[model samples]
Target: MFTGIIEEKGEVVAIERTGGGALLSVRGPLVTSDARHGDSIAVNGVCLTVVTAERDVFTVDVIRESLDRSSLGTLTEGSAVNLERSVRADQRLGGHIVQGHVDGTATLLSREPGESWDDVRFSLPRPLARYVAEKGSIAIDGISLTVTTVDDESFGVSLIPTTLKLTTLGDRQVGDVVNIEVDVIAKYVERLVARQ
Candidate 1:
């Protein structure tokens, strides 16, 4: 589990592909400072296990399922990624509950940059539309953001300067793919209503 609060931005050092999986070597001193083998780290909205922990780099194996479902597969060496350590035992929920279990991907539709902030609109998947609402929480590329507005096919999120400077969303352009994880509570509500 994670809080969607990005601790630091990391860069992909190398990618080693296997038959059905790949091992990603990432450089993040902060997140890897205390990281040990088998620890969980959320990398660009995907929860990956640490297979090896070196000084400032760690390795995680990405399986075929996660690659097919997330934007991580498109990452290459030198690509910047949002990195967050797993939630601690007694920390406040600064952002929403981010399981790092990406449900699907959303494409950037448009970007409205303001003087101090930016409002980004993304194309919403039809099947996941009902799970999103205005003012609800959504995790995009491991960064928690609120839904500023919601339409049948799209939604908007306002990103502050801090977000724009820290995460990859700052450099995102229209048509770029981003991993999205909807609020878990909304999914539970939908499931309960469906059984009634």
Candidate 2:
């Protein structure tokens, strides 16, 4: 599990494509400092296990399913990605509970810049629409953010200066794809309600 709190911004150093999946190498000095084989790390909202950790880089295997479901396939060698290690039992949950299990991918639709922040809108997948609510929480590319607005077709979030300065969202443009994880609690509530 993770808190969706980004520890650092890392760069995709290599992606070696294979028949069934791909081997991805990332340079994340902070996250890799104490990482080890089998440790879970959230990379762009996807919880991937470290196959090897050394120096300032770590490698993880991305199965075909993950590539097809998330924006990870869109990454290039130099693409910047949000990185966070799994939450510890003793630390505060700075963000919402995030499994790093990306539900789907969303396209960035627009961005309205504020004096000190940015209000960004992204296209919402229809099937997941019911799970999103205004003022609710959602994880975009692993960075937990509050939903400021929502409709059947899209949703919006306000990004503060710190977010824009520290994460990949700052470089996102209209048409860019990002991973989305709706509030897990909402999904559970819907499931229980349906059985009534």
Candidate 3:
């Protein structure tokens, strides 16, 4: 599990294609400092296991299923990614509960810049629209943010200067794809109520 709080911004070093999947190598010194072969790292909101860990870089295999579900397939060498290691029991939940399971991808629709912040909007998938709400928490590319507004087809989030400077969202432009993970608790609640 992760808290959606980005530890650092990493760069994609290389991507090697295999028969049915691809091996992803990322340069994230902070996240790989104590990483091991089996440790989990959240890359752009997807929970991927470390296949190999070196000094400042680690590699993970991205299966075809994962490729179809999220934006990982669109990535290339030199792509900026949000990186966060799995949370420890002693660490505080700075953001929110994030399973690193991306529900789907959203396209950047527009961006409204403010004096000190920016309100960015993204096209929300129809199937996942009901799961999002105004003021609710949503993880965009592994960075936890509050939904500033929500409509039938889109949602917006306000980004502070810190977020604008630290995460990939800062450089995201209209039409760029981003991974989206809605609040997990909401899905659980929906499942329970459906059984009643």
Lowest summed lDDT across 10 adjacent residues in model 1 is found at 15-24
Q: Each candidate's TM vs. the true structure?
A: 0.98, 0.99, 0.99
Clashing pairs in 2: none
After aligning candidate 1 to the native by TM-score, how far in Å is the CA of 29 from where it should be?
Answer: 0.5
Report the Cα lDDT for residue 42, model 1: 95
lDDT of each: 0.96, 0.96, 0.96
For model 1, state the Cα shift of residue 131 in Å.
Answer: 0.6
Worst 10 residues of 3 by lDDT: 61-70
Q: Select the stronger candidate by TM-score from 1 and 3.
A: 3
RMSD in Å for model 2: 0.6
Put down candidate 2 lDDT per residue, 1-196, tens digits, no spaces: 9998899999999999988789999999999999999999999999999999999999999999999999998899999999999999999999999999999999999999999999999999999999999999999999999999999999999999999999999999999999999999999999999999
lDDT, candidate 1, 1-196, per-residue tens: 9999999999999999988889999999999999999999999999999999899999999999999999999999999999999998899989999999999999999999999999999999999899899999999999999999999999999999999999999999999999999999999998999999
Winner on TM-score (1 vs 2): 2
Report the backbone clash tally of model 2: 0
Query: Roughly what TM-score does model 3 have, to 2 decimal places?
Result: 0.99
